[model samples]
Target: MAERSSTMKTPLNKALAQRRSKRRYSRRSCGEGTYLGYTSGRQTVLKIPTSRKKPKSRDITNQVDPDQVALLVKKEWHLSYVTPLYQFRYTMLKTYSKELSAFLVSEKQQGQTIETGQELCFKVNISVVLGLAETNQDAETIYIQILSKQVFAAKDEAQKVVWSGLLTCINGDVDYLRSLPPEFVSLPLLCTSGPESLSALVKSWLKKTFDCCFGPICITSTNLQWLAALWTGCHPTKNIQYLKLAWTIPTQPPMDVTYKVNPQDVWKLWDSARLDDGAEDSINIEEVNSFIRGLQTHFFRHFRLDLSAGSLMRVSTALGSAHHSGKIKITSPDYMTTVLQLLTECALLKMPI
Candidate 1:
């Protein structure tokens, strides 16, 4: 009996010693800046670009349908970041449209408190906008329009478009995009312009169908600074008309400052700050800092206050307008891709690992 008990104790002691060795090894590996199971050769951290190329100013109206472009430019879109959609196909848009329409109608019926004749009927239209993709890996932009009419309306009455949404990924990170599995389609940015309730219902439907998630993507102060610099850089090729920035100072009453700069004045400052004499096609972080400093200095000289001390809340130019609350209005199609690329980076940063 004593010999048998010793044999069992030997294996138990050996197993406990092995676990202790593994724990020590793991701690030592972590101290040496290494993960035990992961290879250092592959990058696990996502890196966002600090500098970007100046957008080329080209008319895209001829490239895409005018009506679609009009819809995108006319409305102030609320932004959201979406996760990778599983099993999403561009070929089944018609089926998706029908299904979405039915879903909306059924959802409305369940929550309806109105009389029968006053009930609202919905129609959903989904179409693929061509020529917007910047890479082969990118999926085509999907445009959805929801029209509504009274259930008992006359046949000749025209239905009104109550909601519009766009899902697109332009100039996405190739490595991160390629890392996704074949079945997952990465359209990480969503822009919707419509009622909040309708947006919530649509998001719920998408979540149920695609097995994904959506979250609001608020534009941070840093991102707004980037936009201000990027849009100002385009003044040479495209007239920005005016540059307007809104700042909120935490004073006794929370003062708001709206500083508007002349286009030519800002353009001259930007040109003076450029490292290359219009030779390089890209803008760097140093140049952006210089441009912003010039503006803040000028404002400080006039107001006797530091504009940099306040929070940047909004930025606007002829090309587009962006607010800190995730609202954007793209007024020009020439630089739309560049703007979308920046927004795509923001959305990608919000993705869950």
Candidate 2:
């Protein structure tokens, strides 16, 4: 009976060891579709599936449908890009041909900056019809097609006549210039013949076009007199912010005229207009002085101006009075300083003066 019991104990011990080993290496079914399986590693560890499904490519039709995307109708359009050598086409609609023509002329004239390609679109109250943009690799030319149909019905006859005259000028038909309303007779001068004519053209152009929404005007010509005049004249009435003159040294010196430096103009321009409604004096003494002081401080900090030159020195001297001893002994502004001050003042005042 003892020998039989020993034999059963040996077999029972072996069976229990086998069951324990199988339990140690068994696959564990985790929650959901995932399961942990023991792989080639000797240690009992969970192995996650590494398989990923390959993406399939589906064939789509090559044809493009215009209706599939939003249309560009009745949207305020501006010059997207204009290359120096590019040609422009105006596609007129059946109605409002004059209005469309005027808008086209405005766009073309506005794109006359020396910058090769400019994104200088301003508030002109014009809508785009078909802005056809075509790129030519071999010829290196960009053709801009402005399809100017009846984008918006004119509110009044004034709007119609204003635009029609502008279109006529763009068409190089100056015969309509005299017949146009007296206010817009100057519009025809925008068809610039050469550099000699640009000064007058720019002056007339600014007078006719510079309104509340004109953002920036970059003059590449070396004519500083006209630039200063245009800059001053436009900024007072309109909300023009940017005035950049592309200065190039002319081979021959320009007309021998003394360029005056009037820093008082800056102060006058910077100061906000008084309320005609008879509200209390909005121009606080401390506030106005503080604003001027800040602007002068910033200008001196960024740029080096000779404080000894001309009438500007008077203004510069007065600038110190607002804060410190009100007596800053400085010399006249040098040539470069004068130019810098002119350009800086214009650029700094991004808002209407």
Candidate 3:
């Protein structure tokens, strides 16, 4: 059997050798920087040297950090890609900062909200479980009726917010974010639901943007670490480091994702009475605020967070502290006071603005 097998291999080797002898070996083709034409319907190729190619096609550029850019651009991008709202917020800075700082949040009171405040009330809705129930008003209304605080500090502190209100604001943005190709949503902090179709659409966009903005080697083939980070950020649980592993590569043969944040984990975090530490921490407040500032800087920025009056009060504290710390400053204190009043006014109104 061995002799016969060896004899057969000799014929196969001879056949392969004959084929290789007849074929021509060619060098790598300079297919790029070449133009095509036709002569008498016959195709012709005009090879342009690589040096002749347009510089713009080869010369890479980067996007602005997005932090320093005017808010108008951010707001435009948000509306075109993120959301649609009735009124936009215009800030009045009270202090100043080299980077981040105090914005005099100014707006008029929603008189309609105060007038119709009597109409707002909580009522029972649906029974999801044998014991657990969803109030009808709770399910539909954007916010539960709340009174105006005489003081601004009380307004910025986050209290209980209606799920409906969250839905109204985040839902549209979520849908828009989902609808967009992955590239659009691939901005560092902006993550998507862990749906393959969603991420696949945007992944290339992210790769290109980061590559173009940062550098070609910004994301190479071994970007599992990047994906791992994104996976945790997008997962409903808001647990960016949910998958624990030694942050190394190759030697350990970085294993496949073995653990996933469960649905229960997300519910526990998102369905809390107040802001969970995980939620607060998961969201980079400083970064997000910077992005928010970007939104307001140029185009009108509208963010209808449920925090409303009370939450705004606490925000005012940060705005003030950051203001004093040289993190932020307000050029218009009157405007700042007015903006603060307007935010409280909206909260008292329970209006989704």
Candidate 4:
């Protein structure tokens, strides 16, 4: 009887193993040749980019206030995607500033006593950042800064800016902007550099005021690859100093690999990857892939491990650094527009119909 029971259990275990193997194969087969596209309640699929133009260095110091530009490039900002703001107008910025200030003050004071010399006071300022819009359909960029001070501070003491945010659309998709109603403004991207609590409070106020929704936008590994290629392509005109990439490999305990390449060597590889007929101003997806492959191949020759098997977690150069978690630091102002355009595309992709 014991021998017969053992025989019966062996066949049952075998059947379960076979079923698991079949499921794994099916999942792999389905992932292949899949044409994934973004849909926003439209029958037509959005044509996402497979390639992008090389970033051209443009001196924006003369275009806007130098002080404002300094403030932007100095901080690493947290990113968010904002839906179309219903009835948002550029004319009422002053009124919006006052209202936002009051809203934040009321929120802070709730269920708390205001003690003399102990309570904090808040001030909000909103202004238009001119000359960022490329097309007429694009809305003028709005800059917001929140200043805070102690309620009993000295009269000569100045309030310090505790938070700052930018709402802008630079070279946005024309069709999507045109499709929106006149009342809706397509400032789809928001970059905030501040405490999480203040960021949440400001977002809440904007949502209540403009009937818009905000969602966190994370930079994906593929986008980081694109950024690495784009920034590397700018090496000729701009000094990238060095190229550094971070990858995470799935191992028993997870492994991290940091690969750093000399700027001159990587530039030569990028230049060689370009076709003879390829325009000097633009780079194709094929060239980008080749550049990356060249790096991975070189590393494999020495390490006997393929870096491509791991996920790219971060990419950094002298000009900027981008992480997969959506935090970015722009050290140079020349390529700010290019970065903002890519971020805008990502934000728009997050929009729900």
* Residue-wise C-alpha lDDT for candidate 3, range 1-353, written one tens digit per residue: 01000001111111111111111122112121212110100011111111111111111112222222121111101000111221211121111110110010111122222221222221211111110102221111111111222233353654321111011121111222344443321111121222222223233332332331211111111122222222223334222223221111122433221112233332222222111232232222222222222212211112231111111100111112111111112221212222222112112122111
What ranges in model 2 sit over 4 Å off?
1-145, 148-224, 234-243, 250-353
Q: Kindly provide the TM-score of model 3 when superposed on the true structure, using C-alpha atoms.
A: 0.14
Winner of 1 and 2 under TM-score: 1
What would the per-residue lDDT of candidate 1 be over residues 104-216, giving only the tens digit for each residue? 88888798332223447888999998988888988889999988888778999998888889999987767778888999999999999988777888888889999999988
**TM-score per candidate, in order?**
0.81, 0.18, 0.14, 0.82
Question: Model 3, stretches more than 4 Å misplaced?
Answer: 1-214, 217-254, 266-282, 285-353
Residue runs of model 4 more than 4 Å from their true location after superposition:
1-56, 111-119
- How many residue pairs of model 4 clash at the backbone? 0
- Please give the ranking of all candidate structures by lDDT, highest first, separated by commas: 1, 4, 2, 3
| Candidate order (TM-score) | 4, 1, 2, 3
Q: Which 10-residue window of candidate 3 scores lowest in summed lDDT?
A: 1-10
lDDT (0-100) at residue 220 of candidate 3? 12
Which of candidates 1 and 4 is the stronger one according to TM-score? 4
Candidate 2 per-residue C-alpha lDDT over 1-353 given as tens digits, one digit per residue, 9 for 90 to 100? 01000001111111111111122332222111221111111112211111112111111112212321122121111111111111222332222334433544565476643221222222223222121211111111111122222234353413211110111111111232233343222111111111222223333443443321222312111112222322322233332233221112222432111112233443233332211231231222222223333333333343332111211111112111000111111111111112222222222122121
CA-lDDT, candidates in order: 0.72, 0.22, 0.19, 0.72
Off by over 4 Å in 1: 1-56, 112-119, 277-279
Candidate 4: worst-modelled 10 consecutive residues by lDDT: 1-10
